[model samples]
Target: MEQEQQTICPWCMTEIVWDEEIGPEKHCPHCDNELSGYRTLQIGLDQDDQAEDEDEEDTSDEPEWDAGDEDESYGGNGSAWKDTDQGFRHTNRAWMAVEETLRRVVDEQEEAPECPSCREYMIEAGKQKLNVEPTVHGAVGRPLVQSPIETTLYVCPSCFNTSSILSDKDRERMLKALSPQD
Candidate 1:
């Protein structure tokens, strides 16, 4: 038998299939992002990611699996969901709760990499915004040009240099950088 082709949601990182029958503007059932088949992702299935997999195989523990869902074999405390210590839990939540939880989990787990302005790998940073004072006047009235300030800068492991995800200010900097080369 041929193996099924696998596609992943860029937003939720949910494993999906390229169902042409579903046509374009496909949204992730988990994230509901309008998609056009360009979402390429490599989902990490390391040991830390195994809880999601193990839960699938152990649906016997799921509440809705059996008629009574009372698996006498389980010595569990009859908890609704068992914590896998993976920061992920398997549980039967209401549809709304599931959607909200999935969104939170995906937003935290999915990798967001790209320069927002150039759409290139030129910069990297967290989503948080940080403001910093460029300088400070010392107590003796000596002017300090720089301080230990937050830049919302993330370091590129490759170059060991820090940069921010392209912002309006960074876009202007990119244009200035390009003008000299042009």
Candidate 2:
């Protein structure tokens, strides 16, 4: 038996195993991105700078410590009013409260759908009620689609693309309505 070839998707970091009959996948299943090196970005430090850094050593003439340097404060030990001020404490507390609220909102969200364009996890914005007649071009007969369909809106943080999917309640209703009758 021939061993299957495996390739990792660069967009979503998903491991994909190619089927023998199908050969290799052209696009990633997870992120729907083309499996090509054109989209990959390479980043590294300059080789010459790295070599120079490795060869160089600390050669400062200044002493490591000076007993007379009492004016300097290393770790906020100086008499800076902002460091111990009540206003700063209040601001910090307000920021902490905002962070906690954001954390709670994130925790409450059950689904974070990946954006089709940028492969970034999308944030659920809110629900939108769309009222329009649904039509299918290839279907033999028009299936009954619920009017004023409710959909959950998603916003991609990276690309700022907006997309919507049928809400859970409406999706279930749609599936049941479209299913073949026994």
Candidate 3:
């Protein structure tokens, strides 16, 4: 089995594919921060594992809540806050959804690629086509030719650093389009 080497950017904590090609001015491809003396850190699925471990621990001393327990504890009408129990349940569900979304966003940030310039997490901005049109010198009836190069763009949310690169397939297409036709 081949072990893949990886490194994390100290500034952004983004995982980077380790390559010796990085020179003395070694900059993170994601955050563009110097990595000369930085040490590699291990990342694991420890958060989930820890959570599972806690769930498995005994908690028999904790009191379980019954229906209308909140009203009994507070000595107030529960319906004063919400019309029905179903309404409270719906609100709880909505809050749970919101919490889940927040968790997902944080997870995405943890896994996001670092911005080369800003050392922050970069997000996919959009796809754009860079067209290189052939210059025409007043040609009569010659069809205009242009090569459309498609590229994916990423942007740093912090420093607004933007990067664009063509995919392998797009590079092949661009090369074919630019090459002289038979």
Candidate 4:
């Protein structure tokens, strides 16, 4: 059986099935980026040494696939979708969650937000729990002295550096927890 041709988009890094039906002037379906100058890429495909060098020259400063994701498929969640005659079906609920998370991550990647420390594109590492103590009240008034601070963590894919920022509601909650009761 012949395998379908596939390539990663230069702009969004989305894996796409290369089809001539869309013609050469086609744009990437995911990011709508132009595919005119971009070369078709496939995994395990043999190219001459010159072609390899050309490929490297064509691809520079591209958002590489995360080292963690390189070994795994479908965001390392083992999630897959099957197209039934009826429609489509997923393996499980966990797969659905993984799919959603992957979509969000890709969307964020397209935005190309730079990390403050490294000046490299930061990827969302998801939410993290932080134990914070009340500054004003301490343990004197409030029974629940220490609480969990939920914040979104963004990690630099290049440097492996990380930074977290809390949402407005989380900041307000932390302040309220620290405020002394009259």
Candidate 5:
């Protein structure tokens, strides 16, 4: 039996195949663009060919650490603040969403948050379980009060971090209703 020619994407170099279901003369599914050229017995940029292009150097010179790294990581240059400084401290990317959700939960019925001892409002960024759940189920009909997902808390103003758990029962119920669905 003979095989039809295989094409590759110019942008991504992934092998392309035409599928009747996808449509005739389809784009390289890998890159989702038009396909051109015919398949050869062997195709793609060989190692030596790729290496040649890679050897070409950037025209401009820059400091080793300064090149190809995010400026924010470098403390925006020459500031007295270091990585440990409050200003330089990490903000959990999800902070605002988590804090507002938690605050709304606080506003609703039942349990009071132990009112974080920290001087500032605390934000819930993401959660983790520092310890393992006890495996054995207490009773079949009774739903296990699954352990809390340990969460990292950050102070709203300082972004100082801490953590605690509502009781297993409370945490389970609160998480179902308050935490982001997705």
Candidate 6:
């Protein structure tokens, strides 16, 4: 009897057993990622070396500031600072526009339903009417669902999966009707 060798997939964390006749697997069966260490990465750091490097400030590239030097690049004439200020203002304006658009798209619903397939927030597309037979059972005892029940349709932007939920009015009516009678 021989022991079977197992390799753990780095991408999906699934344990894979190599077959005796097939030898070792070159790729992970679960995630299909290469098991040959091509996609793997390792990082190491020394805290003492990092602390020493941080303590030594390298100012070799920086130009010395002098009051007599009136160069525009050295901020002596204030042109560098003005250019930086303008760039900052432009960046802020662009960021503000992006935030406004995001707010309009994402904040439409306070409690938006998540798509079952992609787990992304679904946007309300439109209303749909479902014709249900009165003889169909709504509950164990309750028969007769209201015909032409209205439902709100939602579409997932990411996966384009369409789903529907009962309208607020119809949901309330169904809840009230299903309540146990005194």
Against the reference, the lDDT scores of all candidates come to 0.51, 0.75, 0.65, 0.66, 0.54, 0.76
Candidate 6, clashing residue pairs? none
Which of the two candidates, 3 or 6, achieves a greater lDDT against the reference?
Answer: 6
Candidate number that wins on lDDT, 2 or 6: 6
Which of 3 and 5 is the better model by lDDT?
3
| Residue-wise C-alpha lDDT for candidate 4, range 54-121, written one tens digit per residue | 88788868576765564343445434322222355436888778667655775765344577877866
* RMSD of each predicted structure: 21.2, 16.4, 18.7, 23.5, 17.5, 10.5
Clashes of each: 0, 0, 5, 0, 0, 0
Which TM-score value belongs to model 2? 0.41
- For model 3, the stretches where C-alpha displacement exceeds 4 angstroms are 1-113, 133-146, 173-182
**Number of the candidate with higher TM-score, 1 or 6:** 6
Residue-level lDDT tens digits of model 1 in 32-124: 876565646576757656877887787774466555656544434444334333456556668768557544643563343544444433333
For each candidate in turn, the TM-score is 0.19, 0.41, 0.29, 0.30, 0.21, 0.47
Among these predictions, the greatest lDDT belongs to 6
- Residues 68-154 of candidate 5: C-alpha lDDT, one tens digit per residue: 464665666634356456566566869977777767855562433343555554544444555546354343333333554454443
- Ranking of candidates on lDDT, top first: 6, 2, 4, 3, 5, 1
Best by TM-score: 6
Instruction: Give candidate 2's whole-model lDDT.
Output: 0.75
List runs of model 5 lying over 4 Å from the truth: 1-115, 129-131, 135-144, 147-156, 159-161, 166-170, 173-182
- What's the ranking of the predictions by TM-score, best on top? 6, 2, 4, 3, 5, 1
lDDT of 4: 0.66
Model 2 stretches astray by more than 4 angstroms:
1-104, 136-140
Give the per-residue lDDT digits (tens) of candidate 3, residues 16-57.
775445422368777777877676867677688886788778
